[model samples]
Target: MTDAALSPLRGLAKLRKAKTRRFSSFDRTGGNDDRLHIEPGETVVIAEHAGAGIITHIWSTLACESESFLRKIVLRAWWDGEAEPSIETPIGDFFGMGHAQTRNYASLPMQASPEDGKAFNCYFPMPFASHMKFTITNEAEHDLLFYYYVDLELHETLDEDMGRFHAQYRQDRPHAPSEEGRTNEQVLFGSENVDGKENYTILNATGHGHYVGVLFSVYSRRRSAVWDWYGEGDDMIFIDGEAGISVPDTIRKPDPRIGPKAKLIADRAESVPGANDAWPPTLHGTGTEDYFNTAWCPTQTYSGPYHGIIAAGGPNWTEPVTLYRWHIEDPVIFHKSIRVTIEHGHANGRSDDISSVAFWYQSEPHQSFDRLPGVAERVPTFRAPYRNWSAVVNKTRS
Candidate 1:
């Protein structure tokens, strides 16, 4: 829509080969009847299940490669009821949910023994009545082998306290002038109580930690609210016991260097749940990098901060491409089901572009899920998947 550079592909249905079967109710007592299959370089998934409450299980695997950078792979599913699902286990720590060592990033793919592979199980529980679906894709850029294991297998467990925890409170990166003015402080964790009241208390123990920012998200079973709804930028969660929720007194100061031409947008803003930094704060700079990804060069010329343009060159190369598809299923209420697929393509950095002939569908929206990119608002009434942005690489011809 905006042109191949910003959003390369539009209205391209990469999700081919549709299939489905009726659900006969989950057997929480034990056993699973749900299964899915994927061929090399293919995408597959269960779109969505509609209603008040439902459960889903998913499994996936990536085969070994001779010269590839993949060792082990695990699927990241959305937390059923919240914005920030759970803290991601640091690459090497292996302390959070989602099994698989960060080393798996290297080791799994080195298994050239033909039998080398990767896989995992994901369990989802819906608090309210809702339809659900499980999905997966083979994104290895090479041939991959995978299988799906799913079905509503209900059971009671003493370990229930351990699965799918939500966030209560989080600390974020100190924005802008503050970074240069103050000593760093550790962020505390937060969570909501049973009465639906949100609460966050700082974890003041001194230790080494990374401070990008923190997002405070709340999850609920009712469709009255979906996940990650940002009223402004990010909802501002206050600093505990700090004056005016202010920074340490030693760090606060006014810059006398304010020039005559400077402008103020808003005195202060709040942080949203699952956002990158803490709330009621200023960012390090103008947050301009979020707009332009210096990581990739743009071929086409454009002069607006909000516009995304891409470019590439090369004789026998697959030019960078973007894919698109829409959900044919109805609004995803609590229990209704639906399917979504991703398209693919091969571009020669010029005129020759071979679009994807494949697509994958799934019920749970992916973290990498994104709104079909463009300003046209082509499809209304649909909640776009909020996916992580990818680097726009332009291939140079040899």
Candidate 2:
């Protein structure tokens, strides 16, 4: 790691043999224009490079009339001539803001700067050996005006062990609602879950790599319930585990030998069917709030180098809540495949809109992502339980 407090002379000496290049959206015709105009449904190639290089920095600012434009514009990046993009996500969510809203926040690999968080920056080192291609697609109705800069450090030779950067976005609007007539209390304390099949999936990747981090956002919809907290779910990550593991119908019984250190344990053996004795969670977190580096229900917004709760929602948790966690100091390494998932609520009970972006580096060619939902489906919607004040007043009077 390059120490930031080194002497100026030492810094200069270290850079004497380094070669780097930058690709920007500045006017190519030597004019004053420094932005690109992207029409509706248009795709623009922002950066294309051949040979070995590491994209060290990315900065972008966009202008659009639609409030949902941030979620409409899609960004995709391909490395090493792969047909499938290694990075594919909405521009805003890719930078940390979700639900088409922006706010100033900072993280080690990504950040949204001041002035209402219009400036999006990323410092993830995306190294490509043969070629790298990045493009932005405008999926909104209105045209988009954008300015971007992709700074790259071109190395004469790249290290053989360098991994390619990858990111994938996924969203489940109102994760399949809990079974009808199932109350929150029952879901929380009565219901048991051994296999994580019903959990909201953050990432299901097959590769040999380390997960750097993830950005998760949720828009609450349940209102009838007195309690509006949305993060009671536990985080379960299976690393390099066997495939086609049969899920039990009932929760599994906890292993007596594992001791209490095991964060996630099978509640009952009869619940999980065909689960082998060796099946155990690789990394388990206490709760969703705990996984994001927060305790209890977070009500205030905060940002840091590795984790942050960018948006904490409004009164009654009605608004969207966004959180990010970067495993820079302690990355989750996986040799074969990894499945990262978290419950929507305790035991997959709550029905709320959830979306996430997973960032990691791995050897390509990676599994291609499924087609993204169309613009109509991608748009966010809010639903609250109906309230009748008159009825309450009448009942109280009677």
Per-model CA lDDT versus the true structure: 0.23, 0.80
For residues 1-398, could you state the per-residue lDDT of candidate 2 as single tens digits?
A: 46467664676656534467888889989998899999998998999988888898999999998768988999999988888899999999999789988999988789999888989999998998889999999998888999999998876767788888989999995454455675445544335456777888788777678889999999886753344578888888877653333455465564334222223554433223323112446676678989999987889999999999989986656778999999888988877677788988876777889999999888876767867777787788766533654564455457
RMSD of each: 21.4, 6.4
Candidate 1 error regions (>4 Å): 1-37, 46-59, 64-128, 139-142, 151-244, 251-279, 282-398
What does the lDDT read for residue 118 in candidate 2? 86
lDDT (Cα, 0-100) at 277 in candidate 1: 30
Worst 10 residues of 2 by lDDT: 269-278
What is the TM-score of candidate 2?
A: 0.84
How high is the lDDT of residue 292 in model 1?
A: 26
Instruction: Give the distance in Å from residue 215's predicted Cα in candidate 2 to where it truly belongs.
Output: 0.7
